[model samples]
Target: MGVIKVLTGNYSASEGAALCRPDLIAAYPITPQSSVVEYLAGKVHNGVLDSNLVQVESEHSAMSVVEGAAYAGGRVFTATSAQGLALMYEPYFRMATLRLPMVMAIATREMTSPETIWSGQQDAMSVRDAGWIQMFCDDNQEITDMVIQAYKIAEDEGVLIPVNVCYDGFYSSHLTTGVDLPLQEEVDAFLPPVHFNHATLDPDHPISLDPMTPGNLLMKYRRSHLEAMKRVPEVVDRIDKEFGDKFGRYYGGMISEYRIEDAEIVIITVGGMTGAGMDAVDAARENGIKAGLVKLRFTRPFPAARVAKALEGKKAFAVIDRSVCFGWSCGPMYMETKASLADAADQYCHFSAIGGLGGADISTDMIYSTIQKLEDNKETKTELETQWYITE
Candidate 1:
């Protein structure tokens, strides 16, 4: 059994991490995500959690500490947002390539240089290629559940990769909602003790880590990493089913499809804005437009096959992105989705709409308008130029 309680997304993530009973937690404080580590520290101070809480001087040091701890065969956790994540990029990349199984909570925020600390997915999207399994949650409950499932997915024997459970910074991180807190005993039963069969820094059996490799050997390592990544989708689906069976809740694995059955026009979205997109689809349906939505939960593996399947028969589709793709002149998700549907490019119309940067609100009406755009261009068989939703 589990208890229902109102909790902010940050607190929910902290609670979920605590429930997993990690051996160690290393993190530096940053906006939005600072409260997560703060809550965990309180738990450590109050004796609710027995894990060692390392308060490092900087985000870089924090990641370094966790890499060493994980290398020593301990299950570890960490949290950060925005600039903190940027600072930790060095160790962050190493954590994945070394194939260390760990979980991190990222309260996604916009990058600097207009110098703001609101909410955006740019921080996490910026690191999509860093070899970590990235997942986005639409709400606090999903945030809590995903944190627990993330450990299982990351520690799978076939996929020993780091996982980043990301949610919109202020949107999800600060929003309060009721969450079902699962029992510690239940969690323990669901997640077995982590067994590290890979290399470790044990004194008895010494090993060199991340040594310089020749081009051919490096290619082999890269190929091995890709093989492991290919195994992630299966592991993710299995864990989602297993977690649902035990905890009574499940998010559709990888990507979630909503109202797409007979839809002729669809809008794809990610993160907290998904709920609004679903509502927009419903409104569009009421107005006699066969509109639907696809919420992308996992971005690293980029559910290309699933996405293509969901939009297969649709007349037109649009991807709404909160972060831009810089040189691509559109959003990252838009470009990726287009690439995923490359084989079907001549079959239907496609468009990219970008907005919600720096914590801007993505209202239901905006989504409805996007669906209308798709509907208007339903018969066209060409990709449109990127549309900026909230032109300043």
Candidate 2:
């Protein structure tokens, strides 16, 4: 068993990465995400953790340096948020395309123009299509454990893609809570030393890493990358199970459910606001509402089949998202959830609920109101308009 310590989400993430024993760490500090790498650097500089820590000029350089280190056969880690993530997009896309198995922590925050450094999912959501496996954490422990599991998932022979461990900026990032820090030996056993099938990085056997290719070949690479993504659901499930067996803490694989067995109405959520959603579910149940909650753990793969099964017999559902899908009036997760129920859109009553942008509060009352709205519209068949959780 590991020691239980009260740590903030950023410190938990740093400790998690250190437990895996990264070969190289590179990152440029940015709000919410800044303390994460700072914690790691402190360990390296204090002679407590043995690792090569590089202080880069910017998030772009941070990603580029780690990309090079990854190509040279090293297990690397980095993190950023908001604009930092925007800056890292160029090399970030390349990191996944090059099939580098690494983990980057995202202390998710709102984008600029309105100019805020507060909590929001927009930063991570903006880069969802950039070809990486992304997962969100509900708490500090999850932030720590997911980092360990992320490496296992990424380094799998069949799934050699990068991963993003995303959690809300001030909500989860700066929030302090008790986390059972995993023992080093146990983590070492759970995560094997990084290995690659290709001999490109090997000095004894040098070859082209990623040279210019014909459009036809580039198309092939794209397909191959997609095929690997299709395999991520199973990998995520298996790794979570394995982590559970070792640590005695199990998070239901792709999505976790709370009392959804015979629910007539359900509420779905992503990122840190899931707690509020669950509280709303409990409150609804007390008021004679058959309410249930489904937490969307993995967003990139969508887990459509699993979501379909979860919502199979439900009469209504509401997806609460912290980021907006400007293309539509609703949030991105709402749009995706609706798409998952494409054939049965008319079979159940549902709507998109957006809130928690720019550090806004997504209180239990807000979610329960959505649940109440779902109950009211449960008999209706078509999708309802988007609901924004605004408080005075």
Candidate 3:
């Protein structure tokens, strides 16, 4: 039986990690993400979660500890935020390239420049190409569920890559909501013990791990890594169905479409903002506008095929990005979506709408307005300029 409990997103992640039974947890404190580790630490101290909780001095060291532990044949976990994630980028990439299956929860926050510690997808978006499989959650329930599913996805033999469960900082991280906590026995049945026949620091079978590689050998490793990433979508779909069959909750694999059927315009959104974007689509529908929404669940694999199929016959569409793409003059997600739909670019009118930066609220009105703009310019057949939903 599942337990119905009201919990914050951070707590939900902690609870999910506990149920997944990580053998080791190495984490350093950072805003928005600190509570997730803290809660796990508490569980460890109370004997509820029997795991090694390493109190590291910095986020970089924290990741390094997990990498070492994971290499030693232990299921490991960690949590981080914006700057913390950036600091750990070195080992973060190495962990993925090394083909270590581990789960990390990212309470996504804005990267510093003018310096702000608030909710933003900039943290995760910045490392989209770092070899880790990344998935964003729309709410606390999804956060909890995806954290559990992440372990399954990462440990799959065909896709032995690290998985990052990212949720908007201060938004999903701090927000409290009801979540259906799964039973421990059921979770254990769902996720078996992780077994990897790769390089390990086992004393019995000692061998070199990550030794210096020649260009030809390194290219082979890179090619194999790309091949593993290609298997993610199918594996994610299978696991999502299996989980939903047992838990009665199904998040559409890779991407989830809301009312795309019989729609002429669509709005693409990621993470927590998808809820508001869906509401705006509902409003547009009530007002006689055929608007739909595409919630991007996985961004790392890019979901190009799924995205293209969803927006296939739509007259116009706009991607809502919470993080900027620096020189692109659009959001990171917006650039990715545009690239994904490049083959079908001439089929629909498209534009980018960037907003919700530095934890700013992306109101429904702003989303609705974006939909309205797309509907208004459906026949323009010209690429529209980037729209910023911020007051000067």
Candidate 4:
């Protein structure tokens, strides 16, 4: 039987780590994500989790420690955000290309520019091509759940890629919430030990990792990474279903569709803004407008086919992005959604609304108003039809 407990974001993470039972927990203290490591530190100290909690001096060292741990056939876990993520860039990319299968949580925060520290998806977006499977969360519940499911997907034989389970820094990571913590027995049943047939530095069989090679071998190594990424959708779906069977909640897969069936227009969003976007969809329904919501839980190894299938016959759609693509005249989510719907029959309408960057509040009212804007724009039949949600 699975144990039950009420948890906050910090406790949720600690419980998640407990569930996975990693061999190493290496992390550096950064705001938001720091609580996760702190809670785990206590667990390590209390002897509840028999793991090495390495207090690395920097995020770079933190990732390096985990990579070394993972290479030694140890299940490794770590957490970070914004600048911390930027700091770990070098090893982070290598972890993906080498298919290390380490699971890390990123409390999403704004990257430096105007110089205010806050929550946003920019940090996650900045590393979209780092070859990791990225999962975004709409709330604390999803944050905890995704972290657990991420490990399963990452370690799957078909998809041996590292995963970043991301949530809004203050919104999900620091906020108080009622999370149902699962029992270790059930989690243990769900996730097996980190067994590697060919791990780095094993005495029985020694091998090389990230070794310098000529162009021919280098191309094959990169192709292997791409193949691993392509296997993510199936792995994610299977893991989510198994997790749902044990945990009683499901995110469908990488992309979750909300009320899109039989709807005329759909709003696409990723991250914490999804909850508000769904509420706005309900409001639009009350007004007899068939507007739906599609929240993308996973960004990298993007579900373009799923996105297209979800919005295949919809009359129009809007993408609500928290991070800008810049120079593309839209956000990353918007561009991806547009590309997905390019071959649709209904002439696939798209509106881009940017909001909630740098910890900015994205209220339900803002989302409701944006759907209203889409309704008006759809009716206007204007020559130019893209609009950005902004404040004067």
Compute each candidate's TM-score over C-alphas: 0.98, 0.98, 0.99, 0.95
Q: Which ten residues in a row have the lowest lDDT in candidate 2?
A: 197-206
Instruction: Report the alpha-carbon TM-score of model 3 versus the true structure.
Output: 0.99
Model 1, stretches more than 4 Å misplaced?
A: 204-206
Q: 271-377 in candidate 2: lDDT tens per residue?
A: 88998888889999999999999999999888888898999989999999999998889999988998998889679999999999988988999999999999999
- Residue pairs that clash (backbone atoms under 3 angstroms), model 1: none
- How far out, in Å, is residue 264 in model 2? 0.9
- lDDT by residue (tens digit), candidate 4, 225-271: 89888888988899889999888988889799989898888888888
lDDT of 3 by residue, 262-319 (tens): 9999999999999999899999999999999999999989899999899887899899
Q: lDDT tens digits, residues 1-392, model 1?
A: 79998999999999999999999999999998999999999999999999999989999999999999999999999999999999999999999988999999999999997998999999999999999999899988899889999999999999999999999999899999899999999999998888988778988888887788899998898899999998888999999999999999989999999999999988999899999999999899999999999999999888988999999988999999989899999999989998998878678888899888898988899888899888999999888888777845
| Number of backbone clashes in candidate 4 | 1
Candidate 4: list runs displaced more than 4 Å.
1-4, 203-208, 343-346, 379-389
lDDT, ranked from best to worst: 3, 2, 1, 4
- 158 in model 3: Cα distance from truth in Å? 0.5
10 residues in a row with least lDDT, candidate 4: 379-388
